[model samples]
Target: MSEPRPAYYAAHEGLVAEARPKPELWRLLVGLGLVAVVVTVLNLVLFSVVVGFGSNAVAEGFLTGSTPLAMIILLSSFGFVTLGVRMAVRRLQNRSMGSVLGSFRRSARQFWVVFRALLILGLVIAVLPPYDMGAPLTPNLGLSTWLMLLPLSLLAVLIQTSAEEVLFRGYIQQSLAARFQSPIIWMGLPSLLFALGHYAPAAAGDNAGLIALWSCMFGLLAADLTARSGTLGPAIALHFFNNLIALLLISLPDNLSGLALFILPYDMSDTDMVRGWLYVDFAVMIVGWLTARLALRR
Candidate 1:
C-alpha cells in the first residue's frame, strides 16, 4: 500500500480490524477500565511482594527502600501492564497484539534505528559538564550494585515505555481513528487521556500541571510519529529513551530512584528547583522528538 499522508488518523492504515470493524465508542471506555484494573491489581501484588508480604511497616519505608532487588521487581511491573493491554486487545477488539504493534518487520527496524540514534545523543550529554545542575542528590547505589542492575533497569524502562505507547498511541488512537475520520477525535482524545493519566500531584509538587502539559505535547508528538512511520517503532523508541534517561540515568530524589546513575541535587518537593528542572526537560523532549521525526524522514 502507498504510505498514507502523515496525518493523525493515518496511523490506523496497517492495523487489523477483523472483530470490531467499527469499534463502538463504549468499547474504548470499557477498555480503559479493564486496563486500569489490571494495572492496579498487578501493582498492588508487586508492592506487597516488595514489602515482604504485605507489611505495613515495610510500605511506610518503601520510598527510601533502595535495594537493587526491590528496584528490579518494581520496574518489572511495567511488563504486566503491557500484558494487560494485550489481553484487552484480545477481548475487546479480538485482534492480535501484533495489530497494535504494527508490522513487526517494519517496526523492528525503525525501533532500533531510533533507539541507537537517541542512545548516542544520551551518551554524549551524560559526559558533558553539569553546567547549571544545582546540588547533586545523594547517590543511592554503589558502583557494584549499579553495574549489576543497569541491564535490568534498561529492560524495565523499555517495557514500561512500550506499554504506554501501545495503549495510548497504538490501541486507543487506532481504534478511535477507525471509527472517526477527524484527526481531532482520533488524536486529541488519546493524547488528552495520556496527559491526564500522567498527572502526579505529590510526586511533581507544584509543577504537576506543567508536567501534564508536557505529557500532552509528548502524546501529540508520539501520535505524529505513529502516523509518519506507519508503526509504533519511533514512538516507542522516543518514549523509551525519555524514560531511560529520567528513570535510570538521572532521577529525582524520590520513590523510584533505586536504579538511577545520579540523583537530582534538590528535593522533588522544592518548587523553584523543580521548575528549573522542567525547563531543562522541555529542551530535551523537543530535541528528542525532532530527532525521531528526522529519522522517519530518512
Candidate 2:
C-alpha cells in the first residue's frame, strides 16, 4: 500500500480517523504511567537514603561528604529507568528500537541551533540591570570545578530534560494524537499535566500563583512546538537549554530557584524583580516558538 499524503495525514479530520486504526494508545499510556510512578517512588527512596547518610557524615564533620553525589545517582537511575521502559515498550510493540533512536539522531543539528539560541538568550536575561540577575555569575564556581564538572552537569541536564521531552512531547503527545485525532487533546492535555507536575510544596501567597502560571505557559509552548515539528526535538532542546542555563548560570532569588542545589548571591526578595525576570522568560518562549515554527517550515 502507498503511504498517505503528508497533507492528508496532517489534517485534523484525517488524523483523528487514522489515530483509531491501532488499538494501542491506552496500553502505551498505561505502560508509560507505570514507569513514571516507579521512577518517582525510587527517587524518593534514594533521596531519603542519601539524606540519612549525609546527616551522619555531617555530624562527624566530614568534608568530603556531600549530597551532590547522592543526587546525581538518583537522577542517573531515573534516566536509566526511563530508558529501560522505552526499550521494553518498543520490543513489545514489535517496533524497531533503531527507529526510536533515529528520531533523536535526525534532529541533532537543529538541537544544537536551538541550544545556542537559548543559551545566548539566557545570558542576555542574566545580565539585565533591572533584575541584576547576572550578579550571581561571580561566585558560581571555581575554574577547576567548572572545567571538571560542567561537562558532566550538562550531560545530566540533557538526559534528565530530554527524558521528560521524550515522555511527554514525544511519547505521550504522539500516543494521544494517534488515539484522539484532536489537536486539543494531544497538545493541551500533556502540557497541563506537565505544568501540574512542577507544583512546588513550598510556594506560598503570590509566589505560588506565579510559579503555576509560568509552568503552564512553558508547557503550552513546548506542546505547541511538538505539534508543529511532528517530533520532540525542539521541545527537548528548549527544555535542556532552559534548565542548563538556569542551573549553571542564571541568578534569580532563592525562592524562585525552586529546588536548586545552589543559591544565587543576589537577593531577589522584591516582587518587582521576580515579575521582570518572568516577563523575560515569557519573551524567550515567544522567540523559541517562532524559531521552532521556522525550523519546521524548512
Candidate 3:
C-alpha cells in the first residue's frame, strides 16, 4: 500500500483540487508566459506614461528613489503581477481567482490572526536589549509626516506582499501540487523561483548569495504555511509584517529604502556586519514561522 498523504495536505487538496483536472504542463507554461507578457506590457505602458509626463530622472526615482511616493509607486506595481496571475488562472485553468485562495473567509480570518500575533511579537522584539546595531539609524521620514502617510503606506505594502503570496503560494504552488504528489516538487520549485527573483548582485555585492538563500528559506516557510493552512492568509500575513518592517519601518541604507521611517547605517555590501544581522534575521524568521503555526491552532 502507498504511504498516506500528510495531514497538512488535506487542506491543500482543496486549494489544488480545481487545478488537478486541468494540470497540463502546457497550461502551466502558457499561464507563466501570459503572466510575463501581462506584467511586462503593463509596466512598459505605466512607465512610458510616467516618462511622458515627468522627466526621465523623475520617472527613474519611482523605481530607485528612497522617497515615500517613490516607494508607494514601486510597491503598488506588484498589483500588476496579481492581475496577471488572476487572468492566467481564470483563462487557463477555468477557475475563479477566489478558488486559488482555498476559502475566502478562512483566508481573511487567518490573515488577521497571524498578523496580530506578529504585531505583538514585533513589539516584544523592539524592547529587547543587545538586539540593536551600534550605529544610529538614519531617519528617512519625520514622525508627523510618517504618521500622516501611514495608512497609504500600509495599503501599498499589503498590495505588494499579497500580490507575491498570490503568485507564489497561491497560483504556482497550487498548480504544482495539483500535478505532483511530492512536497519537494510543489514547495521546492516555487521557493527556488522566489529565491532567484530576490537575487541582486548589483545591490548586495558579496552578500547577494546569502540574501538569496535567506529569501529561499523564507519562501519555503511561507509555502509550508500556505500548505498547512489551506489558504494564502498565513503566508501573506507573514510576508506582510516582514515587508512592513523592512520597507516601512527600517530598511537597508541602499535599495528599496523608500517609505522607511529609518534607514540602516550600513549598506548591503558591509559584509561582516550585514552577514551577522542576516543570521539574526534568519533566527527571527524561524520564530515568526513557528508563531504563525501556533496561531493557527487557536
Question: Which one is best on lDDT?
Answer: 3
Ranking by TM-score: 3, 1, 2
Tens-digit per-residue lDDT, 1-298, candidate 1: 3233344434457762442475787877787788889999988877767677646755654545354455666666767777887888788888888888889999999998888888877777778878547864567677787788788778877777888898889889888877765667677889999999889887787888998988998998888788777789989999988887777767776667767877887767888988887888888888888887776667
TM-score of each: 0.88, 0.74, 0.97
What is the per-residue lDDT of model 3 for residues 121-193, given as tens digits with 9 covering 90 to 100? 9999899987667688889889899999999999999999999999999899989888778888888999999
Q: In model 2, what is the error at residue 222, expressed in angstroms?
A: 1.9
Scanning candidate 1 in windows of ten residues, the lowest lDDT window is 1-10
Instruction: Mark the 10 consecutive residues where model 2 has the least summed lDDT.
Output: 59-68
Cα error, residue 16 of model 2, in Å, equals 11
> TM-score for model 2?
0.74
**TM-score of the candidate numbered 3?**
0.97
Better of 1 and 3 by lDDT: 3
RMSD of 3: 1.4
| RMSD values, in order shown | 3.4, 5.7, 1.4
Model 2 regions lying over 4 Å from their true place: 1-25, 48-53, 56-71, 84-88, 91-102, 120-131, 134-138, 251-272, 295-298
